[model samples]
Target: MSALEAVIPTPQVIERLPGASFKPLAPAYVRIPKPKPELQQEAIRIADLLKRNHGLDFQVAVGGTEQPGDIRLEVAPVAGVPTGKEAESYALTVQNGQLTISAPRMRGWYYAAQTLTQILLRSPEVPACRIRDWAAYPIRSLHVDAARKYFPKSWFIRQIDRLATLKINQLQWHFSENEGFRLESKKHPEILSKSYISRQEATEIIAYAQDNHVEIVPAFDMPGHLGWLLRNHPEFRAGEGEYLTRMLDYSNPVAVAFLKELIDEFSSLFIGQTQTWMVGGDEVFPMEWIPKELAKRTPQLSEYAKRNLGPKAEVLDGYMYFLCEIDEYLRLKGFSETRAWSDLLYITNLMNLPPRMQIAYWTQWSELMPSTQKLLERGHQLLNVSDRYFYYVISNRDDCAYKKHVEATEILRNYEPQVFSEKYPSPVAQARVLGSSYAIWCDTPETEDYEQITRGIWPGMAAMSQKTWNPSVKVLDEEGFMSQLYLLAKRV
Candidate 1:
């Protein structure tokens, strides 16, 4: 196989060099311009990969003079290299028996290291080649719904390792749901589930993700999917009645205030870790969730709508208004961007959501959800979490509970980030799309073990990484890709 096919996500440009293949000697050296913390970390990562994959001991060094057989990583503004957000671009050249990886940022170098390791996994003698690579989208991500089913901290670390290997850069940790709240909550101790990741565990997870050059996008779904929280504080229920819905009662001043305070408390943990946060707004009202007799059945919602959203506003208007308030509050708290599932926003024609609030376009199964064009026309940036292409709802049998198991092999062969939905087929413009995300929603965590879940989603995640990085590039067929995967199974 050619060197290009050796890597999982095929490089953007690869051309064979006219010389002998480069081979690493024992006690090889990984040299960086300086021993800065970021540079040192990357060098060590590359060294570790070499040692683990090929059993070739590589020593990390600083400011080394030229050597015959050595790997050099540098970050600078090369004339032809991509700049700005696409700085993840990198150029790896193997010539004159030496290897070099150059980019404008640390992320680029990290990706280059992964690519190099893949090539080495194929053979110690890497075919002389020049590869110029960059992601088509800036936010390739893997989102895990850790709330419904509590995954151990080790599970997260293992996935992060695989994510790094595939060059997937973001992990959307959906840590809250109706069944449970995964993150430790000191502010509301009563809301804690029987098993949840503690504050210290989260800190370690975030730090480890950082080491792997992955950013964790903390997701604390709100207003809805709060069965655990509402069980503790029943006053936050949206409607009256002893059992009422778990949705937050926006009409209650105390509920809204408590939501904001909770947001503040959780934001403290992820303050400097990330600038993107997800306040889930999906399935707020299951069927008939929007009471037809809003005035009589949900007078508080009707009143809240009239008070905040104009007179003559309906319950749908009230829901939209509440979401806007959350979006605005997150902006005030210094989050550059806020994301929510694309259920309510698409149902209404009201373009109330601020442009800063990105829409996670997951499904268009229901006609109520608007087309991709309408969302882009609204000037809202979209992250393609298309359920058809990206969702991996865990299930054991053919008749899964949520949806059929993800056709990972088919996705590896024929999926692209721009295919937002299966029913309403429209190719989203590359510029408007932030990137694509592969969601692993554990509807029934007991259905599969952690190993089974990982095994099932590995292909889908790797395919997502390949397609989002450079969708136009030709890659190995499924069989060839699997062979490559098996060779690099223990890379991380």
Candidate 2:
């Protein structure tokens, strides 16, 4: 196989030079370049793996000066790179028995390491390749529904390691909504009655991800899909109804204050660490903004509007009101932008919206929810997630194991993120497409030990990566993708 087919999300440029090779280790021990103590972990990490995989020992040492040698790792600066690729772009060279990877920042270095790992896995003895690569989207992420399953810290750390291996950089921590909340808050301690994720534990997760060049964005569903947040505190429940599906009552000044304080608490924990915070305003009943459960059973008007009722303007007032407050708070709290479902725009006419609000937007491929063009015209930046391409959806049934689940590879193989550009009118609006993500909602029984959660996401993750990185999917040959998958299977 050619060197280009060796890497998933196929590198932009891969040139092979005959009779070129990189001997990663000597028979006795490889004289590895020394990384600074702060970065020594990565050096030892790579070296130890090479030792285990290819049989060599590295003499352990702590601090040492870094310089060019058989293997060189660098952190360079590419200024004013709003293109979203340059910051993480890197060039790798393997020629004349030497190997080197140069990147703009620490994260770039981490991604370079991922590419190098994939290389060594295939050609551990004498690898021959030269490549320059970057991603099409600035933010390629995975959203894990930890709130539903209560994943352990170790589980998350392992997943982080695996994601970084794929060169997938962003890890969106979906910490709350529906069943239970996985975030810790002193103000709203009840949210963590299960203690799914503690403040200290969150810090550890953040630090580990940062070390691996993964940005973990913290989120807790709000306004809609309250989960159990309202069962205990009915004060937060929207309009009096019999339906168990409760959403935050935006009309209540007290409820709004409660949400603001809750957000402030969670925001303080994640501030300064990430640019985006997900204030979930997604999937709220669109028409009356009430629980759909009641409509399923009761056919009434005043029965559900939750006291916040009126014409278009008034219907949107309560929901938009909290969004306005949450966006401003997040901005003030060191978050550069906020992400919400594109559905947030559906309730009210796109006449006026907080221009700063960004969207984690998607539509059912067959039945696109928010019009891609309309959302763009309304002037909202997007983290495009076409449910067809990105969502590994499963029946919410407690027993819905992958029995009849659709293989995501089928949809993703033909899907590309660049199609979003067509929906935008101009280059300016097109640029608003920030990146894209894939999500796996809980589909297993609460007591199940979590063996089936990754079934749908695994192979599909690589496909999504390739589509986002190599947006021109049609140009890619089928043989190349199958070979890519074959190589990935061995490592995964």
Candidate 3:
């Protein structure tokens, strides 16, 4: 096999050179010419990775010119490449017994370090090659349902480092769900009745993620998936039915106000850290129980619809009204965009939804849900978290376990950010896609421990890193991919 093929999320350009492999000599240094703090951090990280993986003795020497056998990190324009200045793009060249990593931005330098580490993992001697690589999508991400499973802060920190190595830039922490609320809330201390991630720990996780060139997209799913919150304040519940209790009562002014405050309390914590907030809008009243629950709502819902939606608005319009209120509130809290699942079926017109909202097109399980093509044509940007391709549902049930295994092979062969359905084989233009993500929904939290969860997701996550980084590239079959993945796998 070509040594270049060992690199995951394959580079856009690879040119093999005629020379001996460049192996780092002992007492080598990761030479950083510039004294920028960020560059220093990158140099330290690269040096540590080399030490851990290859047992090479390397030191991070800041403010130095490159010497022989030195791994150099530089922040400068990548010459000769016409489109080299994009975000997270990097060029790596090994020649003249030295390895140099160059990019125009911090993230590019970080990714170049990752590519270098991956190549070195296959063998201590680096192949003589030049690789120019960049991500096709800007928001390559992974959504973890910690709300259900309650992973510790260390778990998130570990995963962020792992993800950064694969060039996955975003980690969406789904910290709220019907079963549990994983974030500590001082305002509502009772919500921390279950295992939770505290405020200080979350801050640490965010800092760690940023250091590793990863952004933490905090997801506090609202309106729906409110079982844990409603359990403490049942007055805010829409209905007493089994499923209805999971949803917030949008009709009640007091309830909506309470939720807005709740959102403000937690969202304010993440204000400076992240610009995007995910207000999960999936699997609400779009199913057969819509009418049954609609009738349960007091006359306040109708009043809310008429006043906020329109004079002739129906009960279902309440969803859009509640979403808009939350969206507007998030904007006030300094969020530039809100992300949600594509279950806004009650929205009669596209103009009614928030302009800054990006849709996570996860499912077409509901016939009433809008088609992926329709949503794109109507000018909504989408992140394809297609359930068929990307969901890793960990449950004890036979069907759920089957789904976890079934999609593993399928994703390796055919999944990509633009793919939502097999029926619509034509992919949407890259301009309309923000990127894609693999989702780990722990429907049954106790079914597996954190180690088990990581093991379960390893293969799928490996496949996803490749697919999201460059969706159109040729992929290895399941067996080939897994073999290469195991050879390249390093937990740290």
Candidate 4:
């Protein structure tokens, strides 16, 4: 039999190893040859943790190069350990009462270190025998949309650290929206200065997220949901153009210039090798306003409304043009990835997007299957975020029993089968399902009492996380999951 087949545990055996009962092998020693400062620090931290928590010496050493042995805890044991190179290999061995871990590169070593932590934390018994493992998804992601409702930076980073513990790699930050503009934009100071309560606070949160093994993908809602920006700068709002107006003057050249400058400023603030900019193109309501303005400017523009019953078609056309302009501006500024709500597929042909652009399929509406299908056929990557299953906001109120929220319970009940099941075939033709995200909109959660919100959503979100992480993983029972979630939340 192959090594992989040999290591596969039987269902009966797997059932015995609950997440809480897992523990690492003890009385271990780690060896690293010519370790850099970061690796060295990690080694020391592991050793200290072992000594403090388990009363094990957990010795660490820097020594001459050697191949890694099979083991749960492998310290770097080789000289010439590469740093920052992608796709490097690592090995860990625990054979004949000796344990060794070695990597050709530092990134590999870092990964090995993470794996060691997981095995140590998640296995029911100490891993006394030889074992080997590696990452399956290079881009394992967890997204938090702070734009809709801001979360404390401390809470954000704490969650990042917890995600790193689970080996999740990417943290997508939905940073701007129509409700509030969360990031600082110096070029258009009006964007954040007037809309957001604090800009430096948002930057501090980004810095904290980066420190905890998470790559932040910041999103700014454009074209349609520029209401927050328009609220701050009346000139950017459509004529009748009062501050707090819901629509932007997309036809105005000055407004376009302001948007371009804001995009540039955002690009500069988040300058990093791994950062991605998400420009949201979703939910353009009040189509009547856009066409009314257009018809007033040029009576002949009324001809564009031929397909539709009213002037709404002209308004939608103007909105589509605005979306394309934002897409082009971001492309020119070196941002390859731009995400929008799934509706962008139906409202406008996102055919003008750069080849690298990605669309987030926010399947909140019931009739989103067709739109999702069209987006995939158009050759764009999609992130599935079905609200019924993944939205945390639709939960029981504080005074209500969990079952009292019939709509919320119904959503949780049907979410899994509806979104991920083979029975509900993907609407997208090509099926480029990048992953999924659970949106925790905090409109009613104004008091910042996350405990109640979290408690209400735990069982559902945990199931969502599992489905996102491993599609074939069995759906867990609610009671069993809640018991586990309580333990996990305490750790967080």
lDDT of 2 at 214: 81
Total backbone collisions for each predicted model = 1, 2, 0, 12
The best-first sequence of candidates by lDDT reads 1, 3, 2, 4
CA deviation > 4 Å runs, candidate 2: 26-69, 76-84, 126-128, 193-195, 242-245, 286-312, 364-369, 396-412, 420-430, 443-449, 473-492
Give TM-scores for every candidate, taking all chains together and pairing residue i with residue i: 0.94, 0.82, 0.93, 0.70
True-vs-predicted CA distance for residue 67, candidate 4, Å:
14
State the lDDT of candidate 3 residue by residue for 251-333, as single tens digits: 88889888887787887667786789998877766477555546455456667778776777766676777777788888888
How well does candidate 3 match the true structure in TM-score terms? 0.93
Error of 4 at 393 (Å): 1.9
Sort the predicted structures by TM-score, highest score first.
1, 3, 2, 4
Which tens-of-lDDT digit does each residue in 1-492 have in candidate 2? 554466677777777766557665443322224446645566556565445434555543443442222456655543333465787787777766566666675566656656766666666544566677777778778988777668888878877766776778888888776777777777777666465777898889888887777888876777777857876787667555533246776656787788778877777667666888888877665434233433443323222233434433334444566676777877888887788877646544523557677777665322324566666666777886656556665455655433344454564555656454234323334467777787766644353454455444666776667767756444346566666666655554
Candidate 3 vs 4: which has more TM-score:
3
Candidates 2 and 3 compared by TM-score, better number: 3
Number of the predicted model whose TM-score against the real structure is largest = 1
Residue 125 of model 2 has an lDDT of 44
Clashes of 1: 1
> Weakest 10 consecutive residues, lDDT, candidate 3?
343-352
TM-score-best of 2 and 4: 2
Tens digits of lDDT, candidate 4, 130-153? 333333223445556566565666
User: 1 or 4, which is superior by TM-score?
Assistant: 1
Q: Give candidate 1's root-mean-square deviation (CA, Å).
A: 2.2
